[model samples]
Target: MKKIGILTINDYNNYGNRLQNYAAQEVLKSLGYHVETVINNTDFNKKNNKSTISNNKIQKIKKITPQKILKKVALLLRNNYFYNKRLETFRNQRIKVFKEFTSSYIIETDISITESNIPNEIVDRYDYFVTGSDQVWNPNYRKGSPIDFLTFAPKNKRIAFAPSFGVSEIPKEYHQNYKKWLTEMHGLSVREEAGAKIIKNLTGRNATVLIDPTLMLTKEKWLSISKLPLNKPKGKYLLTYFLGDISRERKKYIKEIAENNDLQIVNLLQIKEKFAYMAGPDELIDYISTASILCTDSFHGAVFSILLETPFIIYDRENQSSTHSMNSRIDTLLSTFRLESRLAKNIKNNKEIFEVDFSHVQAILDEERRKTYGYLKAVLNI
Candidate 1:
């Protein structure tokens, strides 16, 4: 059988990242290829990402008053970055759950590839290396990480499958490097329309805009790997998952919705909710698929909700102006599915927001899956 290596984000903390990684691996395996997710971590990526982060922090500090900055810092330390950051207890169990899902579901290469050790022989181990199904191309997040582009592999052996830029425009700092690496890839496809535009502008090559790999699999397939949480409530509930900070007003909106609908509110990402917060890729499919309604600011959160045919509202995540924002991918997703009305900023007395029509979604999903499969088949020559 032909062999393929998958390269994606190292963040197992993220539901989207791991889900996409698994989806990419599963799709490749179904195509009759031996697939393993390459574990790549590097100090080079870390240093660059840190530099960018510190620079952004510095810029942020420069704009705010000393009192304001101190208040923000104290707030972050106290509430742990408003629920995005967690105490050691949350991280410990959450990471364990993440790894459990990964070990059980994703087939990974035995070797951990890093900057210091590139493993020259490994290039021959896999027929092709594919960077996929996530925002691996975002310079703010990736720091123009060469590994994400599979630069160690021969250009003909490198393929980018539905990787996203995550922003409308590339920062000027990463332009040259992005252009060079993107141009080198043999087969290119992106997850969002904005990503395709960026690819065209950088490489003067039009890339196919493919659906996220998570959507490639049917509901029954996802359910095959899904598990119910042991402590799940016996009652109907409204599910909320937010990767960004959830403001007081937003929480009020969620509470009001749950109260109005006579449903329990379950915040999957809330660190304080120890029982439900330890959810992994496996349990989340059950949580999302069975929810009465879902509210989220995450792209993947919206992705699964749509796939499960659950009523959901996509809130615009915080920190939109930052270069690191990945909201463009979410925008492209809603537009593609004709669900633009679901995005909202204010939820005061909006009864119409709860009603979603999934009647037209399956047809779009069918066409998208066909196109994605066609692209993968031709690109990989399977």
Candidate 2:
């Protein structure tokens, strides 16, 4: 079997990252290729530490008024506890789940690579290199990391599979860099229409818009690995998987929806609520598949909800700004399935009854899967 090495943001403890990584591996395996996920230990460590530091700095700056500073200091002293412990706890729990679910599923390289140094022996070992199924090309996430561009690989061996830019447009500063790296790829595909447009603008290459790898797999394939917690609530539950902060009004709306529907609200990512700080990719599939309704601000959350045909409401990520907006991915996803009605903004009233007809969705998915498979087959010459 020809060896295929995948480079992606797999070490992050996010549901989408792991699931997409797993999906890419499985998809390639089904084509009879030997696959292994290339773990960049340096980038992994950087992402973990950088996110924590940046978040803390942002929060401190936001709350740095004179009175608020004093209040924060007083609260810190009064609590008499190491608040950083909470963050550590969350990180540890997420790492545990990542190891158990995501890590175990992929064939990982024995040797890890770093951003500054990639061993030539490792680079020459793979017949082909693939980057993506997530926001691997997003400048904000990478902070100018070129690993996703497959720069170290031979020009003919580089392949981009459903890698997303995660933005509607590439910033002007990065256009030249993008052109330099992406122009050499043997095959290029993106996860959204906007991403394809960016590639076209930057490299003058018409890129194919492919479905996320998670969507490329059948629901049965996902269910085969799903795990449900023994303590999962009985009966109807409103499952939420918000990655961003939830606003007061949105929280109230969710609560009201649960109360009216006689459902319990189960938050999957709210660390303070303690609902599910340890949900792995399998558990996430289980939750979405079994939930009576889903409310989320995450791209994978919406994808799973749609795939499972669960009633769902997708809210825009909170406090979206000029530098980064997650709306494009969600918009493209919903539009692809003709499910734009699922956006929370489209609903005039919280009390209004909502439903999704997946009959049409299934047709679209079937066609997309064919196109995606064709692209991969032709590109890999499988």
Candidate 3:
């Protein structure tokens, strides 16, 4: 069998990142290709070693005065003493969840590599390399790394499938670099139209706009792997999967909607909640699938809600700036399915429960899936 290696942001604790990785692997496997996710341990270690918010704050305080330095040390000790159990629990659960999910669903490289350290044996093992279905090209996420551009692969072996820039525009300084790296892709596709436009302007390449790999699978396929949490709420519940901050106004609206609808609000990202903190991809799908209504500020949250045919309200991310806005992904997705009305722009206008008819949405998804499969088949010569 032909072998394919997928390079993506797979080491994160986020539901969307891991699910997209698994989805891409499964899709390729179904095509009769042996697929393995490349685990870059050096990148993973670097991300984990980065200073936390409290550590960064403590660093600022250390330079103030001798007394403040003492206070900073005390604060650090106190925080570690008080929160160690919860922090350890979160870490252990997340690691277990990732291990269980990946071992059961996806194959991964036994050896991890950094950009400067990739083995030729590893490179030669794959017939083709896919760089991927997430924000791998987003500069903020990549931290100026060229790994996501398949720089390690030979020009003829590189393929980009629904890889996202995660921003509306690329910075001017990186245009030349993007052009150079992307010039070598044998087949190119992006998750958003804005990304496709950026590629066109930079490399004069007309990239295809493809659906996320998570959407390439049917709902039945997803449901087959989804496992409900033991403590899943029994009654009708309003599921919230916000990745960004929730404003007071939005919080009020969410509460009001839940109260009026007699629904319990289940927050998937609420750190204070044990259940939320322990949720993995399977639990995430279970919550969205079982929810009476879903509210989120997440791209994957909206994607799964739509796929499950659950009524949902998508909120814009808080504190979006000109250069770093991620709302375009959600905007493009809603527009594609003709479900723009589902966007919760104003609380007053969204007083009633939102209802979505997925019949038309399913038709659009079917056509997009067809195009995506056709692109992959032609590019891989399957």
**In terms of lDDT, which candidate is strongest?**
1
lDDT of 2 by residue, 251-342 (tens): 99899899988898889876765547677778889989999889999989889988888888999888778558878878889999998988
**Can you write out model 1's per-residue Cα lDDT over 265-327, one digit (the tens) per residue?**
888887778888888888999999999888999999899989998888888887667556678
- List residue ranges in candidate 3 displaced over 4 A: 44-51, 54-77, 346-352
- Model with the higher lDDT, candidate 1 or 3: 1
* lDDT at residue 247 of model 3 (Cα atoms): 97
Model 1 Cα shift for residue 327 (angstroms): 1.8
Each candidate's lDDT (Cα)?
A: 0.86, 0.83, 0.85
TM-score of each: 0.89, 0.91, 0.91
Error of 1 at 360 (Å): 1.4
Write down the TM-score for model 3.
Answer: 0.91
